[model samples]
Target: MTITTDKFNTEKAPKPVGLYPHARKVGNLLFLSGVGPRQAGTTKIPGVDLDEHGKIASYDIEAQCRSVFDNVRTILEASGASWMDLVDVTVFLTNMDDDFAIYNKVYAEYFADNQPCRTTVEINKLPTPIAIELKCIAALSE
Candidate 1:
């Protein structure tokens, strides 16, 4: 199988925290990193704040959720993939109950045509105060 990475210069996407690109394409699959709403080179999104050491942001759920997905879109474009190529997604939310509606609103935009299989769950924590993080598997060269 062949492998490649997708990178971009978008300020709207979060900077990688380690020795990794935002997404990597292997064979027909683009494996995406888990993403949050934090802007590139910053710890917080515009209207979000850290409540405690491990608490997630209690901001407008829709906006924050949308931001993370937007970052995903950029990464997909960089990988020569698109939302239409998504095959599966796994979402981790610190507040899934509170953010489900917002997630649905934004998720629908990308998943309208070929809805992928998905699973979401509320977790105890995520990186920074971002409410959610999403990891995806997408068709890369299809």
Candidate 2:
């Protein structure tokens, strides 16, 4: 069978920083790109304060995680999916040790019932100052 794909974008989510769409659908699966905390059409990142040199001066992991998940939700909805439809999520964090607990708490509030399979890992840096990002996939509703 030939597979067809479609790119998904929405104004409710932050504009992609590079040459990629927010998500893509191939048949029933929606694959989302890394979703971050930056607000749509603005440079503001919810959980981060930047220094003069654009470094993270202070950060709140919970805020960042919430924003990222909200952004992901936007894309998912735009792609005809929902949080409950999500089957897998891959999370990236710059400081996992210090941030995991808060992130997990906020995450539980969203996914406690639907509880998708998840994998989280520490990374050196992301494209922005935000502390967390999520790459997710969902099975599209029939």
Give the top-scoring candidate (lDDT): 2
The candidate 1 region of ten consecutive residues with least summed lDDT is 3-12
Candidates' TM-scores? 0.81, 0.97
By TM-score, how accurate is candidate 2? 0.97
TM-score of 1: 0.81
> Which residue pairs clash in candidate 1?
none
| Candidate 1 local Cα displacement, residue 62, angstroms | 0.7
> Best candidate, TM-score-wise?
2
Query: How much lDDT does each candidate structure score?
Result: 0.75, 0.91
Expressed as tens digits, the lDDT of each residue in 32-117 for candidate 1 is 88877777667667447556674533577777777787777877777678888888989888777777887887788757887889
